[model samples]
Target: MAKFKLFKDRKGKADQAKNNKFVKLGREIYVQARKGGPNPDANFGLKTAIHNARQINMPVDNIERAIKKASGNGENVEYDEIYYEGYGPGGVAIMVKCLTDNRNRTAADVRSIFNKRGGNMGESGCVAYMFDQKGILIIDREKFADLDEDILMMQSIESGADDIVTNEDSFEVLTHPHEFESVKSAMEAAKFEFSSSEVSWIPQNMVGVEGENAEKLLKMMDAFEDNDDVQDVYTNFEISDEEMARLG
Candidate 1:
């Protein structure tokens, strides 16, 4: 399998990371609802945010509370969506998306993590141009044991998918940002379900990281995700399978 920037593996720290995921996801849902209103059916962003939260088994109560907060029935905090760009230990481009009520605090925390982890924060557009914003939907192979890859590819293409990448355990459908909802809806109408779905900044090219640099890069990403203000992170770094095994 190609070493794409899948951040699911965290050097055996999945449990720790998951504990913090709910808070960040709650913030994301709140921000989305606040921006587009609390009605998920009428708000695509809110619907996607709620879908992602549910995918992780986030509590229904938490999801509803976030919507209530956004609707002015709960907390009145307003968050700003911000993006930070930088280079990791191996000169791999990294972009962090944040939703925070306090910009200065989030900026300081991000900069400190980067500096302490053998990285340096760059100007706003420094690494943004190296990535493409696309919608990615992942379908597990195990879930559709009888579905052939060719047929899936054909369906994806006919539904306006930009590309279909067959990974070792799943099929990743890529779509233009504007066409994401259409493609996803078409697949759902055909009784297909996604393992995960999101619009993300995909790296145009990957930079290999090994040895000490790879370890440091992973730790750095964990730090970013552990932060309360950070919503998601994107990177161009790719670690070898051997290195990943060693890290595990």
Candidate 2:
């Protein structure tokens, strides 16, 4: 198995730092509600999105307003979910998930970024084959010091988890997409303080990039993440701790 690079702790903060999270959260809520209904109680994805927003300290009023706009008579922004695959610098496979009302606009924007950044957008399924869809659960390490790794491993295995990784400050539980909710519930019932849990694309392998090329790739990813139409961006580029500290 490839060593899972801990990007969440560093990249997550940088990615969501620009006050764009709320807009992204609103868009996700709108789409999830449109797909299932306004009630978070009935929609798992919506509930998860709401949970994520709350974890990030998003205002309650903003969350309520998003739900209301999604359910009530409002300017219905019909967003279509799309994924773009590509290769970034150093042959790193990249996957860009987007929710856009206008495909043309989104495509042009993404294409321009790739072109300028020494990357190119790929055909459907071109780069997706290098990744797998998995349920990822992240828990704060400080709150679970009493929980033995052996016990957690057994619980995860029983819950159909594929893997468990303990980093310096977090526990990452990976499971099949179908077993995500069950494992999440199990951890919650055990009183673990989860920072976030969701299904995401995990790269099967990583490409190591360093120095200026690494910096450029990171900037490209940042630009893509800043786009309102983009929902999530996954890449196989691995940055060393030295690079991360410098970037931070």
Candidate 3:
């Protein structure tokens, strides 16, 4: 829920970022484990959460502890999934997905952040229409430079990916939500390593924000990410390099 920095630029903040990621992943794992069951094989959601945590290099001990806690008394935890919609500076559509045991507290916090950042919180369906849920698989381009792109693309397609594209830094595979796991499994079987895999709500079109607008938007996002209950944040805003430089 911050400025979209390319992965290569995160070395300085990688440790903190990783720690935050662990907390988010642990919450997700705990929720899934409690709701479905602690056994990954028997619970699809738990299995997926574990897979996601592993992708981020979360420690095995940490992962197991989350499940153990869930198996013990996590069922008593009454977390509610809430979606907050808002418009950021420059009218950028935003969606904040949260899982909190205290709805009133989360709502107040989210509303305050939005207000402080010069945005207005809206009803649930306000901005969701502008995004589409899709599965994304990303691989480091430099790591797979020796592979045959045509074959890799072909294989990915044969394995149920919707499309594969190569950018300067990474190779991205797009898939329908339901086909995500199968495609990832096929890629793994074919010895392809992924940098990330997730089901995300991607914006249909990007709205540009600059100067004050960009600053406010990023601040609002940071506030959301800082909240333990806020799981994911999505926005349809794009900032220019010049604006990002000024922000930095």
Best by lDDT: 1
Could you give the candidate ranking by lDDT, starting with the highest?
A: 1, 3, 2
Question: TM per model?
Answer: 0.93, 0.89, 0.88
Angstrom error at residue 60, model 3: 2.4
Taking every candidate in turn, the Cα RMSD to the unseen true structure, in Å, is 2.1, 3.1, 2.7
Candidate with more favorable, higher TM-score: 1 or 2? 1
lDDT of 2: 0.80
lDDT of 3 by residue, 1-248 (tens): 22253321223666776787799889888888889999898886787788878877899998998888888844457578888999888888989889899999999999999999999999989999999887888887787778788988998998999988677778878889999888888888888878767787888888888888887877777777677888888888887777777778
Determine which window of 10 residues in candidate 2 has minimal summed lDDT. Answer: 1-10
Q: What's the distance in Å from true for residue 186, model 1? A: 2.0
Per-residue C-alpha lDDT of model 2 across residues 39-87, encoded as one tens digit per residue: 8888988888889888888888888888777887677778999998887
Candidate 2 segments whose C-alpha is farther than 4 A from its true place: 1-18, 244-248
- Per-residue lDDT for 191 in model 1? 77
Q: Could you tell me which residue pairs clash in candidate 1? A: none
TM-score of predicted structure 1: 0.93
